[model samples]
Target: MRGPRRLRLPRTRAGWRRLTQAVAAGCVLALLPPTWLYVTTGGRAGTVAGAPRTDVAVVFGAGLWDGEPSPYLAHRLDAAAALYRAGRIEVVLVTGDNSREDYDEPDAMRTYLVRHGVPDARIVSDYAGFDTWDSCVRAKEVFGVDRAVLISQGFHIRRAVALCRAAGVASYGVGVADRHDVTWYYGAVRELFAAGKAALDVTFEPDPRFLGPKEPGVRRALADAGRRPAAPLPRDAGR
Candidate 1:
């Protein structure tokens, strides 16, 4: 038998140029979603002091450390707590992954918030927030949150706001510092793909991982937080 035929490759200069152009075009297309998310939500995320008061402050989970919240997570909780104390948000919904018994993110988040002076009655724990999309979907479907203040790091808040809004919770965001460390940089890099995924999620509108009958969590939490008025915030609130 003849030796395996040499695989024919694009040998011409024009063919190589076309291949390069195609790759460049693909990269540009991939970047569109991240660009769109940043532009659309840039104005909506800011410091906690600038965030508008909403019906609930949805604190998305960062990682945990030794059965406690990591510093990044603690920062998010701090912002939510400040929002609570300022009377800007009526309730705090701690949403995180709790798939494993030993690594319970939501429970750890709730413990941190409670220890920081947030009343347990005003804290609603969402144990199924496996991802940003899951948290956004469950917040709307299970928790009955129509509007919310999202809390996360600066690099992530725009995507959070976009995903939550697409999930039908009219939402703003409070972005904490990015920390400028290895973890923060890794998260920022990951957000490029995450933003693209979010765009597709918004387009397809997939159901959440878990959906149950609407619980009274949102209403009860708000009532327990003293039924803070949902008045319109100043235009500069989202500065």
Candidate 2:
């Protein structure tokens, strides 16, 4: 059998220039999504103290530990509870994964928030928020949230804000602070790739994993807080 041909680099000057240009173009293409996220979410993310007063706050699930909210998730819930206690937000929409019977992120998050002083009645659970995009879509479609303050770690908040806005909920983001640990670094790197998926999600505006019938939880929670709920926006109103 003949041996395989050896790989070779471009031999001519013009060929080398073309190769360099191709590499640069590839880099630019890879960077576009993250750049879009940063620019679109500028001035929209801040500490909870500076977050805009919205009727609802949406907390995305991070993970759970021992059937409880993980430290990162607890920090998120803490911000939601603080917003409620400070009268900055009326309802806490805890959106997370509950696809299995044994692991329930939304319930764990709700329990943590309630323990931190948020009333059970004021917290709504979204059992199908399997990801950031799903949470945003469900917040608007199922829960009828026209505007909300999204909560997540700093590395992930810009993408959350971008996706929620794309999903038709006018959103401000409150990025919870955490120690600069290994998980923090991992999350930061993960956002670079997640941004690409986020760009596709906004561009296509696909349906979420689950788009069930509309729920009255958010409207009822607003009513309980003494605000007359505005009519829910049409599904495509954001576009």
Candidate 3:
């Protein structure tokens, strides 16, 4: 290796010191917005410590690969299913991204719920709920959802509730307890940015991709036999 290669690198102690400073700075930067929002909102910006319950438990998608639900996604659904069994919520709305040609998150969520003993009829899938705001908006316009319990980790539900308030939804959140050893460092960093973006989603009514073309609100079931022309029942029974 020649004669120490002309000593181009920093001394070992100095290099370690610089690396430590960089990591510290990065963590501080990541914590700012959630911290700020909490301070600014009078400490209401993080997860609700013991959130009041609600009607619908909306299960937001965490991730998927090749048509299978990730463990994080499964956690959200498990919480929702528990809520339903405990009578804390009436329905579960599985919202997720389905942008790719072969992936479908909502159905994956649905299958999970059904296999776990949640009745098929109690679950609803929103094919276009690609994000939190979209799910809340579609809840009102498409599914007639006036109240709900947003499901996610403790750090995420705060911004979610704030978004719900902006959309005129009466909502609370159910925080899924996570194992401490699970590695979430990157997601923790990303969530600080997500919080700020959520603050925007609160005030901004950005158009959803499936809004104009998709059917949102419930279609009445057969119109109680022969009332509206769009009703699909036989034409002669009670009329």
TM-score of each: 0.90, 0.90, 0.70
TM-score of 2: 0.90
Model 2 lDDT tens row, 78-126: 8898888998889999999999999999999988888889988898999
For model 3, residues 2-58, the per-residue Cα lDDT tens digits are: 566565555699897898899999989767668755543332222333433444667
Q: How many backbone clashes does candidate 2 have?
A: 0
Residue 154 CA displacement from its true place in model 1, Å: 1.0
RMSD of each: 3.5, 3.6, 10.4
lDDT per residue, candidate 1, 1-239, as tens digits? 79989977689999999989999999999899999998877566789878886778899999999999999999999988888888787789999988888899989999998898888998999988989999999998898887788999998999998888788787788889856999999999999989889998989988877776788888887777677578553332311
Task: Flag regions of model 1 displaced more than 4 Å.
Answer: 1-11, 233-239
Worst 10 residues of 3 by lDDT: 230-239
Candidate with top lDDT is 2
* Number of clashing pairs per prediction, in order: 0, 0, 2
Report the Cα lDDT for residue 151, model 2: 94
